[model samples]
Target: MKAGGGDGGSSVSDEEWERFLRASLEGVPDAPEEPSARDRAAAARRPPERAADTAWRAYTPPRRRSRKGWYVAGFVASVALLAVAFAPGGVTGLFGDDARGADAAPLAPESVAPTAPPDAGPEAVRPTLAEPFKGSPAARWADGPAGITVPEARATGWMDRAEVARALRLSRDFLVASNLEPGVLRGERPAGAIALINPRQRDVQDYLAAAFRSPGEANDPVLLFSRFDPAQARLVGDVVKTRGRLTYAEGEKGAVRVTADVTFVYPIAPAGGGDAVVRTIVRREVVMSWDDPAKVITEPGTFSLVSYRADMTNAGCGPATGRLIPSFGGGGGGTASGPAVDPYDRSTSMDERMGAAGDEECGTATRS
Candidate 1:
């Protein structure tokens, strides 16, 4: 091959690069000083450099280098093409493939949003609001009616006409049971039963009869018995003053199924007559059940017994009449009920609260 020959990265000239390569390798072999002459002389040099150099210059280098550059460029172009073709959808999604699309496509517009909780607001999700009870197992309580092991759930006490008669059999009986003296009862008594004051008292009896319909108005004033007779419970008094009505609220509180606070009044009747003579004061409450029975105590604050009840309530219900009463009880506040007198104002005697019956109230009216 001649001097000035081609190499892979360079084009071939009149003289192959072989001569130049040989000259270069042979320690800068001189060519003629004159341009043209020098070129010719350089071309006259012996065989081109090493065989490796000759072959490299003759064919391999130029093509190989150009192709390598082009291969790199092609690869870059392929990437760019991919980006351009799929980029409109989104850069991150340039691959144009979606694994979750099938499941997503069929849902309605509203369904796109996640499920919401009943209590949770739109701003955030709520796992649950019913947090479990904390503290010792003995102290914790639930949110509904507790266990039911007794029939006290039914009512207070039930009595026959005889029991009602005992409530007010004789004037002296009324005095003894009610802690009143003959002087106090027989007009000779200021604090005696009204029966002593009104015997055929039409207005008194009529008015007292009207009150029997709304027992709630009495609010467990008091119930004191005179003596048993085969007749209805006598009116030791009539409801006159009531309080705590505004506190008549009902709802499940903690363990209690139902709780309510109500106040009422009852008027005392003359010991001899069947008419109301004085008014009494009373405060009471109603409780249905508890959340934790184990922790339950038959105390005034823990639960309630249906010791006494009323005929009407502001809740728009007719007078509640039923055969129910408490079994065991003596005295209590806020929820107290029995045939006893109020230690406070003494306006309402114990007989009124207990649904006391007597001979005075007997023939006056029959049991409804």
Candidate 2:
């Protein structure tokens, strides 16, 4: 379906957001710069690199946005950068770099990553300060549930306006409770989110319950909830930057289908206090449907899961232990191998990245 944004993301149109993300993907420097004393210290505390350590360094966040004032100002800088970088003349001309004859639409960054990365520590950038996202694109993202904006409610097919509105509200609530709730993020069972699922879907209910109760390689909880190992790491700041849109359509059996594709950026630091902060990017696309109570005879405020898919960047390829294992420096986690794809690049749809069913593979990401 052709998805459109609601008033929630009115600050920037969908086309603008897409353009911003696509342009930001360009200009990534290749070589790792000299590490600051703080980064050197953080790297020293990390465990020795494993064969998969290349995966961790690949998840490093984008170049930090220099902040001159409050968070609002930081966001403005990102927008300004997007504007000039994609101006009529390419960024090379603006920066007095090599001239590009006539087609000057801002050439891609010179130092892009190779198809596969080498075994090395991540490039050092700015240090994590009181404001964790000060130097990242996430600085502009809305905090937590606020980013999951619901579209205007309207009747669709057999569903009434009220029903459509309720379906949207229920879907938004479930997304927030499942991914943003503080307890859920800390490895706790997503009880609030589960309570909103249609009990009639016994298989889905059972699967979710078992996933959290006995998490393993096959039934990992991180697929649905963004949980972290408390003993290993804690949130660097209270904010979790989020951006996405929700849309609804008519479904079979007098039902309304709601689709949400949202991207959440989390900044985490090592347990206790640590100098390094890393961002884990998760893009989740969930399809839920609510049938007319008269015809379906299901519980109120509950929806059936039509389909759910996700693509996580910078977080390891698998939830081996059932939680998002963010590699602070060069730590080990689930195995990852594949061509390097930029997590921030949103030019492609989620379906394109996830591919057809049963095509599961541990792919590598370009950056956090």
Candidate 3:
């Protein structure tokens, strides 16, 4: 990226100009005498020399005073042309250069309405909602009072740092202020607030980086291509209820992880329902790796490469074998393999216990 004003035009200085002039003229020869004043062939002079003189004599000479006046007139005309060409507006009587348009107005400090950039990538042009969904795909369990029927995900992993702590702090402040986290996830509702977030692993900073983010768009440091709304939330709910799986499992090692599969569903609603129902079967898993990964690897992200399959704490791994029997191939595609149900305290809330794992990096929060 070009950091400062372009072309170094602002860096020019008077001393530098003087140095440039000196270097340029260092070897230039002295001005030669004007040929017209050298010899006159008329009268006392040899009559204007040869046959070539025909063309020379055709060029008439003016009186000395007139010559001086002619020189002054030419100089004035040159200066006028230079002034017009280099004017503030850079005009040619009736036309302006492209630069003039750029310089015509003072830029606003707030923000300029961005013109479409020539090099924006795919999501740059995507239409996004003003609001976004909160709560993880697996959080859909809160949807069913019958109990979270979502498939039990075998997850394992450990945190290198305590990012979940920071996110919780911010979430606490936000919940206190708004009374409702924009993605209002009322777990078994009409009671207290747990502030579950929407799908974040899907809505990435740059999909390649796997940057972790909060569920709410309002708390985001910078805006994404777009936000989510109630309609989108209802859509998310449908997708989760139908075709989703949330794998949240903890190993004997203190490591913890969770994962889920999700789809984008839109325009879905319940029968005569005011608040839309979340309905979709998204397959998700969480993986937590230990300080020493040699122990376990079966949590959602434990695979590290293709999948995560372990969360190893200083304690040890559960499942005895530490084997993440592949449920599906190619990462949640092809077949739906049943997970080995060693729940190992499966009937509990993943967040309330070890808290959501950090799927992101450290210290680069954007300032809105």
Best by the lDDT measure: 2
Question: What are the models' TM-scores?
Answer: 0.17, 0.65, 0.19
lDDT of 3 by residue, 314-338 (tens): 1111111111111111121122122
lDDT of 2 by residue, 1-368 (tens): 01121212124443453454445323223322211111101111111222433433534333211000000000001112211111111011111112111121322221221233222334433326355654344555566666666788999956789878878877878788777776656765565676666654534544554454455545566666777777677766566767677888887656798878777877777776657767777878787777666655345677766666667765565334667767776333445443345554444455455544444555555455
Ranked by lDDT, the better of candidates 2 and 3 is: 2
Off by over 4 Å in 1: 1-241, 245-254, 274-276, 285-368
Q: For candidate 1, what's the RMSD?
A: 56.4
Judge candidate 3 against the unseen true structure and give its global Cα lDDT, from 0 to 1: 0.19
Write the residue-wise lDDT of candidate 1 on 73-105 in tens digits: 000000000010111111122112221111111
Candidate closer to the true structure by lDDT (higher is better), 1 or 2: 2
For each candidate, the alpha-carbon lDDT, in order, equals: 0.19, 0.54, 0.19
